[model samples]
Target chain A: MERIPILRMGDVLLVSIQVDMHDRLAQTLQEELAERVVKDRARGVLIDISVLEIVDSFIGRLLGRIASISRILDAETVIVGMQPAVSITLVELGISLDGVRTALNVERGMELLASSISLRTQE
Target chain B: MGLESNSKLVEVLGEKGRVSLNDWKEAQWAAIKIRREPITEEELYREASDFMSLFQQAVKEAFLSDIRDPVWLKMREMLSALSISRARRGFTPTEMATFVLSFKQPLFEALKQAHGTDSGALLSDVWMTTVLLDKLGLYCVEEYQKTREAIISRQQKDLLELSTPVVQLWPGVLTLPLIGTLDSERTQLVMERLLQKIVDTGSQIAIIDITGVPTVDTLVAQHLMKTIAAAHLMGAECFLSGISPQIAQTVVHLGVKFGDIVTKATLADAFGLALKRIGLVVIKKSGE
Candidate 1:
């Protein structure tokens, strides 16, 4: 699957997939998306996979792997607006996201990144 | 076969009227089969068909009556009540599978009379058989999980007859082969397990094999040491086996000595050492 459109508001990059994704593409996603997100050393990342109705084992595992790579590049990853079905399915499947952070929607994602960016500016 | 049993059947149906599939099967298989001689296929088919028509007529009359003089409006209420009954007795998959096994005349007779599992024959029956089967499957999975959890918990409990921990390479004696990372909780568990096994087994020796364990840091080594000590307290000797060259070097580098502990290079060697120590040194059979 192709990378979704990139939207930038100030230093924070809103990088969300327009299409629902599967598990097999996680590594390739990290390799490809990492380059775009890292360009000019962007401030923070906002991932919106909320439009996705279902999340199986493979997709859950991929999301975790993606979040870990995002951490290594010195950018905080905030997963925005996971559907209730996705949340329930993830729980039933016992998918663990120990290191990943989350938000309700893009607005909240922006709010979270704003704080992170301001904290960096203070330093 | 000679005399018609309708008069007797009418007499029974007059008092009770309705009979379940199980009761009907008992009446047929048990009451009739033993006393009378075995009948041919022609006799079986004739009797089966006779019962099917009789059953179908009775069901139609009852359903029509139920539809008219009924306070329970929805069919779902009746189905729900049946569901509750199925729950109380704990329905097995084999029983559920039997409900779908045949659509032949005798089975059709039993189903029509019973008003259960007949739903499978109709695409628009009172209740879909597939739905019932799905519910039964989920129940089976739940039952299996509960059984698995119960077995694990009972093993962990302090009961000699109940508990059975995995003891690798054994009939009477057992070897608890330790491998991988050991946290604080795992250390405690190892000690508890070794002590429990020693108390339960009444064996003279135990071998804590560490072959699959890649590296032994201080925490894991300490856990092993604790396990050995716990076993010793119960008057059983503990043998440490499968010390790799890399692990040996790490131990030397860490300056952690064995402190006069029983050590062996391989599992085979450990067995040999155990046998020799127990005075099985000389071969009584062909090979030494």
Candidate 2:
């Protein structure tokens, strides 16, 4: 039962997926991320998937689901560091991952989350 | 008749070698002169002499009916090399075939001299000679065609590479100036190169300039959208630039949707937007 670790930086939760995600692992991650977001009172979720080589429609849907769940929890989700091949595959698979903000890398993702959070707080 | 004709052919080739080789060279010179092929006399002499020796050796050893026999491998290899070079030198298929077929006249003359007053033997020998030389001539033509095809495909690949060039417009912006029509294959290449460049340069904004593209139909629009979608997935915003009036009218008439992707009339406009997205602006110097 391997679990992907979710770390908290300030009010943001960072999940760097370094392993090939399976259905079970994705499901576990979804449950864990939801629980942690509520427990930590996080305002943003940044996911780094630079090491992920393959992604299918299921994983694409999972990303969309995670974004939706975070949005409902009053947090922003920014998926970052997606490989070129994976991005092309996702596009070809017709999964645009709508409603999920994305960035080139973790630093950009953090900036995106910070601005978005600041913008929301001001509103 | 098979083995006997082959032996007689070999014998004539060996006995009157000098006379027949000279006759063969004369016939080749006449053909080259008629075609105005830019082949030097010395080069022609050397190639014909080399071919004669190889042909004599192969005929002495191999089955006359089959040029593809392992014993005739040397002859085939020599002709392949000859045809490929001639093909590169702009020799037509007929000219290449004639280069081999011209040997027939000289060899037939030698056969007539050897089998004088023997019609039956002369007939079979001539038949064997025609079959062998025709097979070899055809082999040369085939090799010529193959060389031409190889050259054509190489140029095609070069054209594909040349047409799609992704350039960095700024530190965080890139532009792909696409030339030629967008087909599925070219689109795939453009997408791959643009995406790889995006990853390599870490550019957040990509502007695809389609000014050089001649037409915009539904299929082209679909391909452009796919590329934009792929870029979007990589977290880089793509701006479509260089939409002429005709292309815009055609796109609207065809009902092709670009969705939320930004479309600009010119690359300069797109560059301006891109620079703005990256928080940069060009201010003209008032003093100058």
Show pairs that collide, candidate 1. none
DockQ value for model 1: 0.01
TM-score of the A chain in model 2: 0.98
Query: Candidate 1 lDDT, tens digit per residue, B43-101?
Result: 43444344434434443334232222342223323333333343344544343223223
DockQ of each: 0.01, 0.75
Q: Model 2: per-residue lDDT, tens digit, A1-123?
A: 788999999999999999999999999999999999999999999999989999999999999999999999999999998888898899889998999888888988999999999999999
Alpha carbon lDDT of each predicted model: 0.56, 0.90
Model 1 residue B59 lDDT? 36
Docking class of 1: incorrect
lDDT of 2 by residue, B119-172 (tens): 888888888889989999999999999999999999999999899999998999
**Local distance difference test, candidate 1:** 0.56
Q: For each of the candidates, what fraction of the native contacts does it recover?
A: 0.00, 0.62
TM-score per candidate for chain A alone: 0.84, 0.98
